[model samples]
Target: MGTWDIGPFDNDTAADFSYRVDEAPDGERADVLLAAFREVTGTGDEYLDADLAMEAIASAALLAAQCPGGEPVTTSYGPKKPLGVLPGELRPPAVAALDRILAADSELLELWEESGADEWKAGVLRLREVLTGA
Candidate 1:
């Protein structure tokens, strides 16, 4: 929950997630990203934890980096090694996770709303647009 900026990898949970991605076997990094996305998307009607949301955001950022017009993840806190070409299949779930995070029950959204960080929300929206090529 130690968020220092609006970027996906700026928070402690997401920074830790980047390490998980870096440490995962090359073929398993996408699994790590999928798990993060599913954790948020599968939350259903339950309150979505901010940490989970952060990890999902980080996951989406990594995937989005490979898309056309997507910015490369340059944060030092992001994965150090290249993630290889991620599956295009991940985009749908990444967008779903983002939608869930922006939903009313998301703790991350609540926190950002309280903090008046419209840019954070906007960043998440931009990620969605990138994933959907909208």
Candidate 2:
């Protein structure tokens, strides 16, 4: 019914390993962010941790704005045949997934908005690339 808090897991970049179904980026912090990302996105089959997610989202802010143009970069897929209209059987999952991801993202955005953390806000915007599979 709530979210999970998987603590700072040791990231081993030397080896290739994926802890979840979604693909994580090269950054260790990004990987941690994705863990929460999946949880918030419900892309994974479980709850997501809050602290770790905060940490990753925070870290991304330190990096340069990778994409200086476009609305935003995303990879997450919603329905296609009827895209925004939602599908018939898989409609629930598609809608749910998008909701989860957006909600998790919203949490961070709201926080940065309140704190006026411009760097974190920038990172949140960049998160589109990581959160969305597009």
**TM-score (all chains, Cα) for each model:** 0.97, 0.29
* Tens-digit per-residue lDDT, 3-89, candidate 1: 898999999999998999999998889999999999998989999999999999999999999999799999899999889999999
- Output the lDDT of residue 125, model 1: 92
Clashing pairs in 1: none
Model 1 lDDT, full chain set: 0.93
| Tens digit per residue, CA lDDT, model 2, 86-133 | 112322332243344335444434544565646544444444443333
| Segments in model 2 whose C-alpha atoms lie over 4 Å from true places | 1-34, 43-49, 55-105, 127-134
All candidates' lDDT scores?
0.93, 0.32
Worst 10 residues of 1 by lDDT: 117-126
Model 2 accuracy (lDDT, Cα): 0.32
